[model samples]
Target: MKRTNCKIAFNDKLLMLFAIPLLSFIIPIVFFGCRLNRQPYFNVARFFSTFIIIVLLWMVNRYILIWCRKRYPRFSDVRKRLLIQISTMLLVTLLGNNLLHYILTETIFTENPVSVFDTDHLITSNAAAMFCLIMIIGIYESIYFMHELRSSVQETENLKRENLAAQLNALRTQVNPHFLFNNLNTLISLIPENPDHAVDFVQQLSKVYRHILEVKDEKSIPLKDELDVLHAYTFLMKTRFDKNLEVNVDVPAEKLQKRIVPLSLQILMENAIKHNIVSSDKPLQINVFTDNGSLVVSNNLQMKKQVNESTGIGLNNIRNRYKMLSDAPVKVTESETNFTVSIPLIEQ
Candidate 1:
């Protein structure tokens, strides 16, 4: 729904071609030569031959409304574009008032050619040139639809402040400082060797900071509340690589109410545990699921030999917040033994 080039501004078409033929020659010499007694020099040769037949039917109705903006574009079929722009403005207002009554009663102000079937001056000069071509195409389509509705409400408030600054930069790369100093040095050595798995790893780090403050201004969420914040972020990446991290999550309680984007599966599982090689001899894994309607994820690879260089900006901020909330496209892929991504999903 974006096509808007109805051109016009060469200094507003040289100020409407020198102010509409000087207000169409001072409105028929101030109402037919000073209030009705007519003939102020035959109303200046019939208002300059009806301002050259209303500037040749206003340049063929502004090139048929700029070719009906590329054959009726803005959201298409509006009753077949008002029945082809009111039947081509009633056939260019009946051929510009029958060629301005045969150029004022016969060729350029009379010598012989008049007989253009005058049917009462062609229905009163084609109903006053079809009411000035329907008030010039209804004031140029209401100032181009109020400047395309204020540019679609300022591009939807700049994509809602760039989707809330990419959900607060994916919750500051999931509580950054090197992922909260490796989950507080794996909760200070599991609070003295597994104090009840360090109280469920501080309740899965307060349930992944309470699901990032309950879906930070959510543009999307569900997939079972993003798989309950990816099971508290894979239980703090399985207590920082316990048995070298796994993940799985095959999705499908009827595609878990399908929706996504907000921290898109914990920023693609923290970019597969930040660039791979999770430990016990390359044990990463990952996965996540749902296929046709998208979601996917994947993983595998195993790069990490001093990995930190990736400035990917969290999968380009979840592919620009799923292109401002959906139409589908986010894919990714890779191969030589997996990397994937996919995404789509949003339906609810």
Candidate 2:
């Protein structure tokens, strides 16, 4: 079984509770004899005396820690807990040693035994050394706990951010279906008069929708992939407008190999079409070109007077998605005659 499974058996409390006292008693008894003059049976008596002291000390330590935890439930501040633990350990050790010494010296150790209290100087010096050892252990435990707590908090925050991003992406994906539906309705209206054009239009429409579905699982797609979708979309528009729709693409093939947020170009194209008019007399001349490491999509502004349902969500969604990846802002240039959108190209 795993070490974590063993820890769980004790409800996550430290397993040192059993081992510490046993080791503490064994070490002192083996090293230090009961009688300083080295009499017979000194080792045996010392072993039993040390064992009793170890058991009592362990009980006192556990009780004190449990009491402190219960009293101050929100006492999670590492520094504060360290101070309390250090203070309690010193107090307990001093009291325990003195109580053990008094009991053994007065009752059990009436014959040849170890000295309970040496003198004024020795008692003070021994107490200081014991206090220092306890404080060091407490500080180490506090630092360890503090580091673990910080890591746990950071992991929780990262998970939350990921969940929020996934929800936002799902909402953005929904916009593509609405755009496809509108374009399909327009193609249906023109199918009777121009059957051949409509057939070509349906083929281009299929390519565009297929691209969207293929890239849906991707957070970002190569610039080349996005341009392929854009080309398909423009082909459908050409089928609808014939020679009247003038579309130009001047992006570098090298730069097109880089990555960009999926459907970014398509959304901008849809926005341009939705807000402007396309006709023979004043034909929609839309341009896609790169300038200064950025892709620029610009078109002549011929605004439609008729207002449509404005969710005001598409541009904001695109902006938000880009923000998650980089610091570069989506630049929008608007005038009486033209509307241009400049999007930064991201390295894969």
Candidate 1, 231-290: lDDT as tens digits: 887888887787888888887789888788777788788878888777888889888888
Worst 10 residues of 2 by lDDT: 4-13
Runs of candidate 2 with Cα error greater than 4 angstroms are: 1-198, 311-313
Measured with C-alpha atoms, the lDDT of residue 227 in candidate 2 is 90
Q: In candidate 2, what are the lDDT values of residues 1-348, reduced to their tens digit? A: 335322112232354555544544544434433344554344555556555665576557655665555455442454576578669877877777677866865688556444555575236434533643464355434554565567657855664465355444534644456766766776887789878878877888788768766776665789998898889988877766767677899988789787787777877776777677877787888899998878899999998888566534456666666665556788889999999988888888
Clashes per candidate (backbone, < 3 Å): 0, 0
The list of candidate 1 runs beyond 4 A from truth reads: 1-11, 15-47, 50-52, 59-83, 86-90, 93-113, 118-168, 178-225, 228-259, 262-348
Scored against the true structure, residue 126 in model 1 reaches a CA lDDT of 69
Please estimate how well model 1 matches the true structure, expressed as its whole-model Cα lDDT: 0.74
Give the TM-scores of the predictions, in the order they appear.
Answer: 0.37, 0.48
C-alpha RMSD of candidate 2: 14.0
